[model samples]
Target: MNFSAPSGEVVADRLSDFGIWEAEYRQTLQQFVQEVIQQAETDLEQEPAPSRPTDVDLQALLDDLRAEIAATRFALQQYRQSLSD
Candidate 1:
């Protein structure tokens, strides 16, 4: 009877053939995730801050409200004139 265990070099070569590719794939995936996270963080940092309500905005809203009130009053006057006529 003659039997011998595989040599260390043979086992190492077989492991490298599969293990190297798996390791490369895992490394690539990890790098991709890291890049995506970094990009998201950078985008969040670059985003503009929310604007606070300013005096100009309030003035513009007030002007719009006044215009609407004037228009409504004018329309009511025209409607009343038409009813009288």
Candidate 2:
């Protein structure tokens, strides 16, 4: 007699693949965050002493960072939904 495999095995395989992808995605995201932080710190440290007022460029940098963080949050939410499904 021949035997057949279980349906759940397919799902388990998919989940395993997803888990690996998720780990890599998380690592990449973390590296991006660290780089952003390092860039901000370096920019601040390179500034001249209190002789000048705050620059508009700093505000632009902050806006860009906020947009990136918002995008990351959206991606995380989608990933959570995929895990549940």
Each candidate's lDDT (Cα)? 0.95, 0.94
lDDT of 1 by residue, 1-85 (tens): 8889999999999999889999999999999999999999999899998897655687788999999999999999999999999
Give one digit per residue, the lDDT tens place, for model 2 in 1-85.
Answer: 8888768989899999999999999999999999999999999999976876555698788999999999999999999999999
Find the candidate with the highest TM-score and give its number.
Answer: 2
Name model 2 segments beyond 4 Å from true.
1-6, 52-85
User: What does the lDDT come to for candidate 2?
Assistant: 0.94
- Model 1 worst lDDT window (10 residues): 52-61
RMSD of each: 10.7, 22.7
Candidate 1, which segments miss by more than 4 Å at Cα?
A: 1-14, 52-85
> For each candidate, what TM-score against the reference?
0.44, 0.51
The clash tally of candidate 1 reads 0
